[model samples]
Structures are given as structure tokens and as C-alpha cells.
Target: MDRLFRSRRSTVYSTKGIVSSTQPLANAAGTKILEKGGNAVDACIAVAAALAVTEPASTGIGGDCFALYYSAKEKKVFGLNGTGRSASKMSIDWLKKNHPQHIMPNLRFKSESVFKVTVPGAVAGWCDALGKWGSGKVTLADCLQPSIELSENGFPLSQCSADIWQGEVERLLQMNEKDENLKLFLPSEDWSAPKTGDVIINKPFAETLKKIAKGGKDGFYSGEIARSIVKELNKRGHPMTTQDFSNHTSTFVEPICYSFLDHKLWEIPPNGSGIVALLTLGLIDSLNRNGTIELKSMKHNSVEYLHLIIECLKISFRDSDQAVSDYEYFKKKFEADFHSDAEQLLSSKKYFDSRSSLFHPDHAITNKEMKEGVPNDMFKSDTVYFTATDSEGNACSFINSVYHGFGSCIIVPEHGFALHNRGGNFNLNPKSNNCLEGNKRPYHTIIPGMITTESTTNPAADEEELYATYGIMGGYNQPQAHVQVYLNMILFGMDPQEALDASRISLFAHPEHKKLSDRGEGSDGPSSNDITCVGVEDDLDPDVVEGH
Candidate 1:
């Protein structure tokens, strides 16, 4: 009986290498790459490629990408900020004049956010990163093969994917559901009851892959693919200019690394909410003078610790609310040169009431009056993430997304792609960042972190010497998740997989993201209180479903 019920699958054991991702296809992609002698960076790209095909709802070629790669040879870590920029042709005043909300204040969005739209930057990003870091054995096609096989032939329909699919059925089927793209991806007569194990295929996606592989990344940006996306946007009244894709470029930037509890943390700058994460850790470090914040202990989990950290969160986030913006704004606005002031602020205990508001940053700017300029790097999209490690001591934590999954679902008929709805991150009825300003990077929700510390010989000694490369994926949840999980790993000492398997709850889900996918709700049904953490403010109940 045990043999009969036992699953017939190979075990994924690895003391030498490990790959973890939201989708199994992505995991396999990385696994294959590692087996072929590809480095950590190469394995990361392979996984990303697989994710683009299998988790289309959460990620794709049209999304933004951020990664932290540790180089074994150089003994250094590099960061990649593959976020897309706003159309260079756009302007803040133009957005004020065009005030998208004026046209569709209550947009009947069938997708994540109509305002969530942004330029697609992932394909170029993937290509660029892989080019710089790939090994001889690695190739785009190698990473994509399994996904292509699954898409063109078939793979099991994940229970989660099926339930999520059904939830979006009405909206997805709005355009006759007969569209070849939709049909090629979903179950049909042959897949009536998509239970735990059912074959689902996406041949169109496979065709898309072929085009991408043959033409290189540019094919997706300039050829038939580009047209499809542009046409779809033009038809929907979006202003994504042809010149937009023509001018698109993804950059490689220095990764931001911070030292904490004998370990270093890493993140991307400005455009990502990563700075906020750093701020939170910095603030906590300031508060925890004893350098010990624990959990699972009755005293540590008490209201006192939670309360102190909550206050710390408020101060740290205020810094995020004020200074974290596009590169132009960060340079022009929060000109204090953070590092110089960070230590002083920590020593003086000077975070609250000394506050940083929009007004504060404005005053801090050297050229206070010369504000009318271009926004070259405002983050504008949703995101996804993954992590991988090679025995060679190289590790990578990556987060990428199409702003919102399928990004606006505003399909470009010609290219068969959708744009991001990142414009939605801005505020209304007030002067705000992340607005529908042209060229502004949107407020991003993906932060990939690496915890590096020397492995200590004394497990019974102090709280030092545990190295880990980990990441969390929900938008606003990204930063908070980073902080919380970092604590969970250090203070609570949970293993990486166990930490990920655990629930991630935010007092508030990012400003607009829904509580995961409806399918994220378990079939076992609602937990007692869909909500958790009384002091926080998400509308979900304590037990219905866990979020992250």
C-alpha cells in the first residue's frame, strides 16, 4: 500500500546546491543548469526563463527584475536592477494635465491595475545579466527547454493555478475566451476536471519562446511581438509610445549591502522599496542596542518587543515615504548622503518627530526651486522572486515581475503581451510621487536580500555566523517580509525552506495588492480569523488564509 500510494518522482536532495522558487518549473530550470555546470547567476536566469513561461500571472518578459549575485571568484556581490522606466516622452505636468484618474477614476479594470502599467524591462534584463554572468554550458534555450516542453506538450495543472484560473475565468474570458492565446494556455474539453494532476498546455507560449530565442531579446521588443503589445495599448487609450520600446534599456547597478549581526544584507537603490528595508534594519539596530531581538520566547513575542519594533517600523517607513524615489529624485531630493547621517541618527535616537515628509525632502534638495525636470528612474511595475545557490559558494536571490501579473491584462494584439499598471502606485488628491508622471520609475514591491556571515564553529555561542540568501515576493510585503524573515531566520533560527513555507502577513498588504490570489485560499477552507496581528491594518481575517 505504501508503494502504491508513493509518488513516482525523483527526490531533489542537495547539500551542494539548492534552488527555491514559487513555481516548480523554475526550480527544475535552475536544477538543470546547475547539473550542467552553470554558475549561480546562470542558474538564476534559467529559473527566471522558466518562470516567465509557467507563472505568467505572476511574472513574465514584460516585468521588472532585481537580483543579488555573489561571485565566488571575486568574493564580491553584484546587484542588477532590471526595472523598466517610464516612456522618456512623458512629463509630470503632462500627467497632472492628463490626470488618468480624470479619464478613468473608477477604471473597471479586469486585471491588477490599469494604473499599474509600466514599460516592460525583463527580457532585456535577463539577456543582459546572463550575458555578463553565464558560463559556457549555459544558454537561453537550455533554460527554456523544460518550460517549452511543458508548454508545447503539457504538465500537471497545479491545484493553485487551477483555482486561481477559475477565479479569473470571467475576466480572462471577456474577449470571447476564444482568443488563441487564452485557449493555448488553459484547459479545454480534454482537461475537464483539473484536479491535482492534470496535463495543461500552452503551445502559444512555446511559439512565443521560439520567436524570442531565434530573434534574441530584441525580437520581443521590436518585431511582431512589440507590435502586438503596442497595438493593444493604443487601442486601450494607453500612451505607451512605439518610441518607448525603441528606447528601452535595463541597467546593471551596484547592489546596496548593509552589515547586521555579523552578516551583510543587500538590496537595489531608489526605485525599489529596498531602501526602506535597509532603513527598517538600521532603525531596529538603533533600537536594539543589546543587539538581540528574539521570538518563540515568551518574553520576546510579548507585546513589548512587537510594540517597540512597530514604532521602529513607523519611523523607518516614514524615511521610505519621503526619500526613496527615482535616482533623479533621490539625488535631487534627499541630498543628505544617507550613510554620513545614518550613524549619527542612530546614536542620537533622532528618528521620530524629527520626521521626513515630502516637504522635508523638498527643503533638503540643494536646487530646491529647480524641480521641473525629467524623472529618469521612478519604479513602475509589479514583481516576482527566486533564490539559488551553487556548491562553488555562489548564490543569488532574484525578484522579477510584470508590475502586476499579466500587467493590466491589456493585451497588445500584435505582440500578444500586456503592459504593467505601475502608474497606480501614486497618490490621488495630493502632490505625490509614483504618479502618472512620464518617465518616473514606479513604486516597486520586490526586494531580494542576501544574509552573509562567517559560519561560526560555536552553535552554542552568540547569535552570529549564519549565512543565507533569501527573498520574499509580494509588493509592499517585500521589504517587511525581508525584515521579518531575516528576524525569523536569525532570532528564531528557522531554515530557509521552513521560513518560506510559513505564512507571510502584513498589517497592510502593499497599497493595492490583493491578499495573494484567491486560489491562495486553501481548499481546506477558511482559518478562524482571516486576519492576524491586531495592530496592523489589512482587511483579511486572522485565519482564512496566510499571506506573503
Candidate 2:
């Protein structure tokens, strides 16, 4: 333990509370909430609002959010699906007529012209979480003060934000061939990106936050803010109505649970890809327990470890691509069968034992050769995730996203925020469960996860001990990162900060590999040779690289 101090980033240990986020200001905002005696839920919402101001390129009021709240009092984790749906009037007929290719031609278009925009659901999600799980110690207005002030008075732009802003602006400019909506994000009238440490403010956004602080969820969902959003969207060719915003509500659902070793993992159900993380972890656990692979003895990022992990991901992602979609639609189709199959896939020791027998320690299996499992399966700058835990042992694992950088980039001229392109995640195929429908949630990628230590004597006792609230953002990387982070701590025994700071790896489907649906029984799965197009950070040991 003493020698571990040699690492640059140490694990953050806080008994009072702790908040982790990609941006520093967002962390400070959540910490302030804790200082004011607010509980984990309040701190989580505060951190989310602050991120809207500080990390505008990645998340905002226009995006959707999902959360896993662990309540100390109840000793249970609750899942909140705060994702928004398409306009109540949207349909496939509209798509076929307007977008014949079944794809958004210009994803950067203004909100009115952007067909991929969805009613922003983050505000409703925040309110739902607070209303149900908050400590009731602080008013919503009190929790939002920091963000409102930041948006109104402005904060210095960090180097990373400036660079991303510039890159986005450049991309939009090249595609649109005009500066139609670029002015909304530029720090000054010259339309230049802010330099690092430069102060920038969005007075309109601040005013919008102020309205929400005063009126609660209705502040954003109804009346003035709502009217402005709809009017602007309608004017831009997309016919969103006030009803779409008003009817929006976040749902509190039972979390999907997976037990690993002595701990239980929790995640939001379909429409969010958290299941992929659970599935990937289950496969890894099964492999290690069966001695098909011994992870504890292998060095971090060793070829053996990376290969196995990537291969597991291949199966997880393939399942997710084919099966994951809106929960309502998925349930109506698969019902209890999905859960039954998932249990066998995850908890059935015999099931995994058979699967593990296929892997060769020294050789790689091709995707074509990789066999499909029984019945089940599983953005970019597009998302933001943060974790908050309070002294009461209550923890909140929160994730928010607009589905793409700058979202639709159509800043509501009145409210001063972009609409999310989450609807773009839906497909055009009528046979697909995730195909677009009016008032239907799209296939979502943002997921928040929680892990709690299991109780020995009684299953009911598990709720009392709060474990950790954590998640990694960045679209598809979310699930893969989840597996890596869990392993770094659970299997590798690294501390929290070290686990997060550790180098990461990801595996892409071999280019030549056909889509899972295209292959038949006994057909080759997603690999061509022992070496796949796997991406591993350069910081690993020399031997791992040489071996790969």
C-alpha cells in the first residue's frame, strides 16, 4: 500500500462525500451542494446542471438523462429513465417522405431543419430524481444557483473545451457552407473560439436556468421556455409542438441486476446499453472462475487479458446491436423470455463453461467461428457521466447526453440551448423493435451503473451498505469502459482513482466481419485471425505490446 503512492493520481478518499466528473467546475458545484447539507440526489442534480454550463459541447438541457440512485434509507437502488421521445406527431411516413435515405443528411442543421431532434428530457429527469430521492433539505432553486450564476456571469473556458468547440465549428462550417448557427456558441461577435482561460457567458441560458429554478420542472417543460422551444423548432421545418414538451415525463423503473462474485451490479434496462457492461463482466467472471483464463496472475493489459476482454466485448456488442431497443417495444416482444435467457447467460455456470471451452489461450477465434448465444444481447462527445456519494451512504450514478456533439446545433433562439439528436439513434426498418415511432424513446447509449456489496445472511440486508457510484461517458465506450474499470479494481485490486486513471482498451468489429444478423448457424463470427483491430493505449508494458 505504501509503495502504491508512486502513482501520480491517487484514489480520492472522502467520508463526507465525493463527486467525480470530467470537468473540474462541475465537481466543485456538486461539492458545494454537499457543503450546503444537501444529500446525494441534490448533489447529483446540481452537478448535472453545472455540467450543462461548463461542458456545453457534450451535454445540456436539450439532452436526455438516466440515473441509478442508491438510497441509504431504503437500501435499494432506483433506476430513472429520463430519456425523451420523438415529437408526438413524428412517424415513419414522415421519414420516408422527408429523408428518403433513412438518414439525417446534415446532422449539424439548425433545430428547425434537424429531423433527429427529440424533446430534451434532462430537466424532467432531474426533477423526478429529486422529487423521489432527494433529502428534502434543499429546494430545487437552491440546488441550481451555482449553474445559473455560471451561465449568466460566465466561466473561463478550459483548453479542451476551446479545442472541441473550434473543431465542431470548423466541421459545421465546412458542411453547411454558411455561418447560420455558429454565432450562438462563439464567445464573441468575431465568431472565434475562446482561448483557454477566457471568460464566456450565455445570458439567455442563465435566464432559462433561473426560470427552471423558480418554477421547477414546469419551468422548462411548460409556459415561456416550452413555447420558445417549440416555436423555434417548428419554424426550422421540424414541427414540434408545446404538447410534446408538456407531456414528457421520466419513468422510475426496476433496475436490471447482475451478481458478480460477492457484489451485485445494477443498471437501467433496455434503450440504454448498461446491459452490455453486465454481460461483458459476467463473461469475464465466468472465464476466470472456470480457469479458462486466470486474470489475477496476468499483468495489466497483457495480450492474454486484452484478447479475452476484447473477445467478450465482441459477443456483448453483437447481442446489443441486434436485441437492444426501446424497453416498451422489447418487452412487448420478448417479455419474460429475455430475462430467463439473460439469467442463463449471466448466472448459469454451466452455460458459460461451455462457451469458455471455445477460446484458445494462444490463438484467436474468428467472428465467423464465434458461436451465438441463446436469445439475448445487450456517443462520442455525445454524453456526460458523473458520480456523487453522500455521508448518509446514499449514492447517485448519473449520465446525460444529447447523442452527438453540439446536438442538433440548433440553439433555440429564445432559450439558448441546442436540441439533442437522440432520435437519430432510431432506425427506419419497420421490422426492427427500435424503429422510430411518435412519442417513442429511441435506442439509447447513455447508462449509469452502481455496484453494492452483497449481504451474507439475508438478501434484504444488501441495501444498507452503499458501495460505489461510477460510469464512463463517450457513446459506445460506455459499456466497454465499464468492464475495464470494474476489472481494474475488482480483479486487479487497484484503488478507485487508480482504476479510473488506468489505461483503457477497446475492440472494434473486424471490417470484413458481416453483421451478426447476416450470419447463419455455424457461420464464422467477428474475427479473422488472432490479431484483431484492437486499440490499446501505449502506456502498457513492453512485453504486452511485443506479445500482441
Tell me each candidate's TM-score: 0.76, 0.87
lDDT assessment of candidate 2: 0.74
* Leading candidate by lDDT: 2
Which residue pairs does candidate 2 place in steric collision?
Answer: 112-236, 367-524, 367-525, 367-526, 367-527, 368-524, 368-525, 369-524, 369-525, 379-475
| Stretches of model 2 off by over 4 angstroms after superposition | 1-7, 102-113, 171-182, 329-345, 348-358, 368-380, 456-464, 509-532
Model 2 residue 46 CA deviation in Å = 0.9
lDDT of each: 0.58, 0.74
lDDT of 2 by residue, 425-459 (tens): 67555555566678878768788988887544466
Model 1: per-residue Cα lDDT over 1-548, one tens digit each = 01112233443567678888877877888888899988777788888877766666667776778888777665667777777767655554544465444333322222343444667778787777778876767777776676677667777766655544444455455532456555543457542324456676666667777787777678777877777776666665556777788677776776665566656677776567776667666656654543344323423233444444444444454445434455544444545354333333333434422322111211122211212221122211245578888887788888877654455555544333445565555433124444435566765667788876643554353223327778777666677778777776676666665555444445331223233321111010111012212233233234333321
Tally clashes: model 2.
Answer: 10
